[model samples]
Target: MTAGAIAAEPLGVACPMDLGWRYASGAAMERFLAGLRERRIEALRCDGCGRRYLPPRPLCGDCRLPLDRWVPVAAAGTLEAWSVYRLPILDGRTGEPRPTPYGIGLVRLDGADTTINHLLAETDPGRLRIGLRVRAVWREELRGALDDILHFEVAR
Candidate 1:
């Protein structure tokens, strides 16, 4: 036994993880994504407080009440916040690191009470600002996933 810190060989092996699993997006989210596939936007309206939730959930977080009211939300919205990633980040879908200098934004859609977080097409900070108008750019072939929205671009 050596004096001071005697590091033991770490008992571990490095290997690529290849696994698959299924998860439920739940009823509310299922409906929401379905709308996206059709290039439609919808939100859950709270009966108690009247707050509309994007990425519709089963209940209102503020009132703790069941949210079943589906209301049409505008395709365009006001940008409430934004960020530019100067560092490359891993793409969760591809499991690969993607080049950076991309923009992301929080948008408060008209007629909706809450903001939806999504990627922004405008990477130039000079072109991005709070309250900038943005609209979803849909894919040519729509799949019922959030990425069906290519990204929100600054509306002309």
Candidate 2:
């Protein structure tokens, strides 16, 4: 064994480790992603309070109702708020910092009261504005994933 491996052996650890799978996954997650792949979006609704949520959930936190029903959302949405991210964040899938100088926004998709946070493609800080119309840029292959809609762009 190499010296590094010998050192790690003392601690009951592997020299080269896979620091993966630090995530939280629940039952509703699969269905939630499936809808995105199918070009549909689903949100949970609180039957008691009449509130609708996007990215469906098992239960409403506020009203405590079992959330079911697949709802379709428009590809286009309104930008409620946005900001240019100077600091990079690790892209969960790639385990690398996302491309620098990107935009992130809270988009209030049509038919859903809650806004979904996603990457905005247009990097220019000046062009991004609140309430701007934005649309999804879909991937060529549908894989039932949020990345299926690669990113949102300013609607022309």
Candidate 3:
């Protein structure tokens, strides 16, 4: 076939996939997870810009500097942004569908410059708002993962 003819031909392919994989969370994340098991919230502070990062990263995105300073962050924070989902969605950790009328929020935890996305206990749109004070509700059993926090609820 000529080069022009080959380029003109449509190409298509489809296949089923069942993939499994494993990855190392790295030293920074490992420490972060470990702290979660102890009910401690820690963040990495950038020396150059003084920006604190939750889930402790190895380097600062803005200053491009190494972030090794660990600081305590409060489990309570301000809800910066939020949404209410009325459709059932699969929970990646459990591989099950979460019921409809759920709430999710981007929370700026105290002492951290960044926000973390997590489930919100308040599903009613009328009660949820930006700058609302929220606190983490922990699971009965402690685990070294973000899921250790069941969800955030409006602080009384």
Q: Which stretches of candidate 1 lie over 4 Å from their true place?
A: 1-12
The C-alpha lDDT values of all candidates are: 0.90, 0.81, 0.90
Candidate 2 has which clashing residue pairs, if any?
A: 37-144, 43-53
- Candidate 2, residues 10-122, lDDT tens digits: the string is 44545744476766657677877877777877676677776778767788887777977556668889999999888878776676787689789999988787898998998
Candidate numbers sorted by TM-score from highest down:
1, 3, 2
Each candidate structure's TM-score, on Cα atoms with residue i matched to residue i, is: 0.89, 0.78, 0.85
Candidate 2 — worst ten consecutive residues by lDDT sum?
4-13
Better of 1 and 2 by lDDT: 1
lDDT of 1: 0.90
Residue 47, model 3: Cα distance from true site in angstroms? 0.3
lDDT of 3 at 94: 66
Candidate 3 lowest-lDDT run of ten: 1-10
Better of 2 and 3 by lDDT: 3
lDDT of 1 at 32: 89
